[model samples]
Target: MASVADNLTMALRKQIGAKLNVLLLRFFDQNKSGEILSRVTNDLDKITETLQTGLLKLLVAIGTIVGSLAVMFYYDVLLTIIFLVFMAICIIITRMLAGKNLKYAAFRQETLGTLTGIVEEYYTGRNVIKAYNHEKESMEQVCANTELNRKATQKADFLTNSVNPLIRLITRLSQAVIAVIAGTSMLKGTMSVGVVQAFFQYVNQTAEPLTQASYMINTIQSALASAERTFELLDSEEEIADTKTPVVLNRAKGTISFEHVSFGYDSSKLLMKDISFTVKPGQKIAVVGSTGAGKTTLINLLMRFYEVNSGKILVDGISSVDMTRQGLRQNFGMVLQDTWLFGGTIAENIAYGKPDATREEIVAAAKAAKVDYFIRTMPQGYDTMLDNEGGNLSVGQRQLLTIARVFLCNPPILILDEATSSVDTRTEKEINKAMQELMNGRTSFVIAHRLSTIRDADIILFMENGNIIEQGNHQELLIGNCETGLQA
Candidate 1:
């Protein structure tokens, strides 16, 4: 029974966990990942722990108590009635204490979730802490969260423990009452001594179930609290549903146009308004602007990572909203400023998109990204294993690996967000040459702050605040000759 309940609990956790992950990607804010992880791990564990014993124990206890009651009434009705009064009193006392136990259980679970979030944040940001010499501050913050968790746990345990002793006291008092009543009935000749002794045996047997019920009460409360937390994540709003028959884009020619697009992270404050742009099928469009000029935001909108507020973005000739997100994203290849590499062999990371790519193809892509020579120098070459986050490689090398992935994908459209930002001067030149090859006959959006990187772009968009104020070729913008409303 315990094993079956465990399996059921694990299955529930998995289903809810999957739903939470989808919510994390689609709607939940990124800052809540730690909180979500807590629910998925610690809270789910609590639920499983409670369910492992709580359900079976509860059912067995209830069954035993019911059977015992039937036997007691058959043996002697008056004695049974006297025992019933004591049971009623015990129940009333337990009912009074149940609410307090549940409240503490909930508090403990909430505090644990917060503590988990603190731990996650501290560990992930440990590097930043060391770099900034903020170890004392971070430690203090951790200590504070841990202390809060400790107090909550202590209080919850206290309340849960209090119930068992109170129940045991009630059981003892009921047994004493039964003893006196049984003795009186024996002396009054209304009941035989053997029958009175049999009733006493039944009362003793009934205590086992009552004891089990008291112990499990705490477990049930804790489990419900944890289950509530899990369900909250599961019931969260899902992503905006895709069209029932969304168009599937294939073999795309990336002619992109933004038609008076407007958006904001918060509805109260519009971040980008009346943004409009168009790119030919094979043009290299450079988006250059100061920090907070909405350069990345534009790419986000184009990728449908977040939907536009007021206008439509069209790919080729179809509204992007009409295309399935998977189909739409598959048409474009992205190489971002921050490189991400999972724990795998060098070749596997390179072949992430084209999982079935041949070794020759992986090596060719690595060569094109200018990291093939470095890979060869490693201990195991392309078979070298990378740690989580590719800690074994330099930042520049990691960036190159990501670029190599884009080279392998060779999608119709490309988004390069500071692709060469982490590379040395010589390596940047090499990557630029390789990127030029990759960009050929493909629509490309290059986001960069360095003038030299985008100098040869067919179009340059100069943005300020939330609006694109000036746009033209690099030379035209350099000479301030464009007739746009604002000067470059």
Candidate 2:
């Protein structure tokens, strides 16, 4: 269990992150995050606190109405009942309008999330859009999403705003009816001047709370929509689960096995089923599959990004669950399909995996990854800064930097996902040599589309759908499936 302070910090972060993420993720927010934050935090907090405010207002109104009615009835029952009847009609009208306002608020929030998701995806894939020359079309899609969000917000505001006007109009009409009846009653000597004056005060007091209550009702409804989203995010499951007494693994022998492991993002939709494999220390394993054939998903499962639907995974004779996520991941280094490099020095980036590494060790790791040679030739050498998507370095150089990071970590298990997929042939050759060096004396799992990189792999597994369709060494699979027209 997290400490109260930790939990509070997380809640605050989520609230802040939701807003920052909305802002940072410019494409996803049609209504913007700041406004959303105000709605969820400020507005919702007001709503929750208003229960007391509403009750107090109602109590005061009730007392005033009761006292005034008592006086009116003392003078004449028929006239007092008329005032009560008019008030009843006003209450019914405002209640219906308040309900409509609430419904609109809920609908607006759903529209906001949808708009946010659209913007996020578009901005993240802007390069792809440019490559395809679909920038104009993409803008059209965003505009359409923005328009929908605007209309939804407008609808909510319009309905909420309608409440006050309707309340005022109904209250005024009820007062007019009361005045006409009371005046006539008093003229007939059935009502006193004091009674009429008190009744007027009571009628306004009744209608005031009724009107304010309607506003509070609408406020609570709008706030609920925002609160629900904020709460849902806070209540969401964390990506990593660590036990109190987590098994620590500073170093591992790197023996891993998938024991009849069947897993999926969704239970009913299995990504890999009945799959069994073993990776011994210092062995090279290749996983080959077409897009969506469970290749990356396999890697994801190994990293424990998603839990297996059934069966189990073991590393060093211990169940994966027996170790902390941090513990399991500490023994391995990974380079994802998407290259990730923070804005930092080349040496800093290389030394990230092993923060306390000596300069000599950092240089050695960089040399092994074929990154040191290039860094030394640069104006700042290892201290060169990579900024704005590593604009200073080519894609190949960025890859080498990632490899340097992996080398510095020197984990017993290495997982590379499409590491060489985007590089040119020349860079690929250099990286392949570095990869071979890194793979020595360690267990490695490599996912690559290029057949040549994995040609010498000890074992190759080809997958289709969620199952391994073929399994063997490259030489054997090639000779056997040569006529079947399989592409690496």
Best by TM-score: 1
Clashing pairs in 2: 27-119, 28-116, 28-119
Q: What is the C-alpha lDDT of each candidate?
A: 0.85, 0.74
Stretches of model 2 off by over 4 angstroms after superposition = 1-87, 131-133, 188-191, 232-246, 289-292, 343-364, 373-393, 449-452, 469-488
Q: Candidate 2: lDDT over CA atoms?
A: 0.74
Candidate 2 lowest-lDDT run of ten: 21-30
Alpha-carbon TM-score of each model against the true structure: 0.94, 0.77
Over the stretch 155-272, how does candidate 1's per-residue lDDT look in tens digits?
8888778878887888888899888878887899888989988889999988868877867876688888888888887788765666778887897888999899898877678888
User: Model 1: runs farther than 4 Å from truth?
Assistant: 24-30, 475-488
Residue 155 of model 2 has an lDDT of 87
- Tell me the tens digit of each residue's lDDT in model 2 across 225-313: 65566565445444434577877777889888888899866668877888988878888888887788888888877877677888888
